[model samples]
Target: MALMTTRPWKHPKTGIYYLRRAVPADLLARVGKREEKISLGTKDPVRAKGLHASALLELEQRWANLRCGAASLSEREAHELAAPLSAWWFDQHRDEPSQQTFWRTDLGDGLWPRRPPGWSLRPAVGAALIEEAADSSVHARCAMEDWCSEQADALLKRRGLVVDETDRRKLARAVAAVMQRASLALHAAMRGEAVDVGQTLVVRPAMPTSAMATPPAEMAQNSLLPISLTALVEAWWREAERTGKAASTHEAYAHAFRLLVAFLGHDNAHRVTKHDIVRFKDHRLASRKRNGDLVSATTVKNSDLAALKAVFGWALDNGRIIENPALGVTVAKAAKVKLREREFTAEEARTLLRAASDLTPGRELPQTYAAKHWIPWVLAFTGARVGEIAQLRRQDLRRETVAGYPEGVWVLRITPEAGTVKTKQAREVPLHPQLVELGFPAFVEGGRGERLFIVPDVKGQIAGPLQGVKNRLSEFARHHVIDPGVSPNHSWRHRFRTVATEAGVSGNVIDALCGWSAKSVGERYGSVSLKARTDAIMRLPRIEV
Candidate 1:
């Protein structure tokens, strides 16, 4: 038969009893009726008495279950409780060896699987235990350990807690001591604020940290930068201000700098020597236009070299570099003087004028078709730049009467306020009666205030002045095939200048009508009476639309 027993012991200091268990080895080894016990390890008399009573109650219940044959030994229960039983046995024999040595021996043997019943008496458990174990000194020590040196100094200064160097030194030492005591990882702990991390404290590289950082010097020297290119461009902008460039010039410089920075990242700027500029020039020559056609090397060389001169000039002035690298680079000369000038022949102008009057089949009439149709005719007859024509307002036109003239003539006063003229001076251009017959009256009558031309319809129903005019002219030029080389807009102006020069118009008189000033003659000859110039412009023959 297997049997079970309980032993009681009590603590001398606390008078607490702990139950100790013991089981017969023969019964434990057997399959049936295996025995187990609970041990109370203390030896105090009062606790021992309580332990004895508790053991009696437990034994009574076990005996009743055994007698009824409802309780039987389980192999798993025996195996599971073996370690706890071994541990209890060792505690009972602890006096034979040092307590630490005995505990180590039991642990090494894999004993103590089950928790001790007296574990509930630990100081971390009950409210009374916590109260009795609380250490004010350690709590203060932990509080002091949380302070960061820099943050503590800032806080003390902000709160007026530091009165002098002594106070600062005292706080600094306190912060250092706290940091040392806390044993924090310096980098990790410094990442956050006093209470939590904020964006201002987030560490990032001082250099270009984006994909759009300045590009290679060659690429940047060739292309425009996107608007999003930030840090380096912004730094350059600040530097530009320090250099005292004119506000408008600085603004233009900033715009160009941003474009360059976005194309080439900031890191490449340092490497951009004079040699790099030469390579960049070659690259631009090889590059294609937005239209997918390869740009002429001469055209690329001319435009980009001029722009580079401006950029390097600004860079030198601002101390971005010590010298202009673009010095001696030259572009191929324009071949226009050798090439015959292409102008609209009288027959071609008539054909274009007729084409402009009627709408092409299957296409809606252009919004500025009326203005664009007649505007080109006027340019061909009067020799005005497209910009000068576009800038004309209804109020600028006047009816002039000269003493020798039989009738009043319609004239346009080209104002300097409109925009830059060829001569950088204002002049009057006469409107031919033939232009009036071709629907100039209706065009002028339809507009309000200073606006002369109607806005043209564009894709997405958007309308504007010059864009619409160019679009319509491009369409007409494509339809007629009138000198495939001649752009509809440029051909008209060329025709007027060619005709006036061939007709023996004085260059100065022609220049006055065209709002051009002779640089040699200077501004003294640039300004002329609006009426006299208007009369000179009227003598030119007009082609009917």
Candidate 2:
């Protein structure tokens, strides 16, 4: 007697097996039953078990789809979802020869002919059009046609597709044929011409192959047809941001996928596989930045692969791809990033200040070279991150008095209200007397915009402009800051710490001054008054440039 294990159920009558899982009451109606079960359809337990596992995996995915909706751009699902309506939309409006067009010359009444009003009112033409329209919008139906055409063109360009006038016509006709049938399905369904469910829809043929990477025979499977990788990425990114992911998180994810799409020969994402993912992982590990150091696998895993994984997982759950190419991929965890201990020695700081001064012209407009010229000096004295300094609103630098203190201090508030920050916790740093002495206040007053810095919004819908400032700061460091061990904008904080330490400033005072969070309860309690920190910072030496 074959016995059923807890995981797989056995049917005693036929000695076959079935896999069963309970459906939640909430999903019972959607799934259409109390428990979901699928017969293994084999007598051999081993074969049945394999089938059982596969079936179980698929069932779980189906349930997930019920919960989250389709999210991928896989060939079969795209075809099933898009081809019918898009084809109809295109067929209803494609260009044709004047002599023998199908609707005009071949069919007596033409597509959507002026059928009898009563005839259309029945559950046939009018009802079918209404039903189809209800399922998808006119805009969506029309957009899919354009989307397919673009997909074809992208593949054609990538494959180096060459075609004569005749071949091009055939390609057009081939795609048109799919759309024609798609239109036909809607018409037939409405007109009572459909004999069954299969007749109510048409199977779309493979996309035009002349420009496809794979040949016709190889492209025979509908799933093998390409969905535009970049298109999918753009769509996914837009949706991701819309659905309330943080702007920074969405940008990070988009950056990775854009790189992936560029690296993978810019093909349909469906064409990529686990093998391609491995190659991408290896390439990232072996790759070097402009500074020529091998990139860390951890970065690839966290930023690149992590983003790709979320996207691919969405695609997989939604049925765009049958399997996630990024699944089961692993990268070694990165050790904590240690900033080099180097800082600006006194002479180097003086040299950078002199160089910065030369870059600032007489005009102090925020948009001018003069304002950009002031950014480094601002970072140097404030010990603020370059981005923090660059993204400041004029109002960020304000005079405020502490509750217990009698004297007012000029403070620079680093907060996300003005721009993005690494630490969400807002803090106030004292404006070094040097900045005030150099007429920083007068320069800001001259600026036209609310922003203190002139970096344009290179960041699109998903990124912050401060990223540009950060990169420029790095470039500025490469030339002006000039020490390999010290990252340019970053070294400012290290140098500030150096000065603070020499002035006998306590660790708690440095933490409060530099926006570092409390590391321990003692440190949290040890935070000194703002005036005390300002006084500590003021003790540092200033040089004449």
For each of the candidates, the C-alpha root-mean-square deviation to the true structure, in angstroms, is 34.5, 15.4
Question: Taking the tens digit of each residue's C-alpha lDDT, what string does model 2 give over 134-209?
Answer: 7534444344344345444333322224434344333433444444554444455445453343444453223221
Candidate 2 residue 202 Cα shift, in angstroms, is: 11
Cα error of candidate 2 at position 167, Å = 25
Off by over 4 Å in 1: 1-280, 287-293, 320-328, 334-339, 360-371, 405-407, 448-450, 453-475, 478-487, 502-504, 522-528
TM-score result, candidate 1: 0.47
Q: What TM-score against the true fold does each predicted structure earn? A: 0.47, 0.57
- The ten-residue window of minimal lDDT in model 1 covers 205-214
Global lDDT of model 2: 0.60
lDDT of 1 by residue, 1-545 (tens): 53333445443433444333343353233212233322333345666566566555654444443344322223342222122222222222223222221112112222112457987776657784576359554343332322223333333322223234444444444433322322222222334323122222222221111111122221222222211223334444565546643333444444444444444564334334456566666666676855355767655554556556666543433323323556656656666543446677777777777766675434544445555566666676677776567656677777778555668777777775554354546667778777777767567766664555444235522124444555565566656754556656777767877778776676777766766556684655435665666556666776654
Best by lDDT: 2
What lDDT does the true structure give each of the candidates?
Answer: 0.48, 0.60
